[model samples]
Target: MKKLNCLIGAIIKDQNWAVIPFGNTILEPDDQVIIVTIPENASKIREMLEGGPVRTNHIMEE
Candidate 1:
């Protein structure tokens, strides 16, 4: 998530309380990770999370 300029604020597993995450934090398959970033970089951020670029169709009207 670093490549996307996103920060992992915390991680929550099961119903336990959230814990502050760090660079070396190990994310589990079911762990819920919270990230913080700006809105301008949302697309790129989402792409990073989704593992690839998301294709969008730009419709033109005449």
Candidate 2:
């Protein structure tokens, strides 16, 4: 089984809110998606979602 990490959130559509799960489900442009994916696939998921990882100042702070 593939382990998927997902973000639980609601999306507003036409004055209505809908719940979405991060998986193989189809998503609309105006729909809020909860990105659920595995650790190994995290890089791919991020790339697909927000184009790329958001740079943080604490990345190398440790």
lDDT of 1 by residue, 2-46 (tens): 233344455556667585454444444454556554565555545
Best by TM-score: 1
Tens digits of per-residue lDDT for model 2, 1-62: 12224433444567685764655444454444344345666565454556323221111111
- Ten contiguous residues minimizing lDDT sum, candidate 1: 53-62
Clash counts per candidate, in order, are 0, 3
Clashing residue pairs, backbone N/CA/C < 3 A, model 2: 5-36, 5-37, 6-36
TM per candidate: 0.42, 0.39
Given candidate 1, what's the lDDT at residue 51? 41
Error of 1 at 48 (Å): 3.0
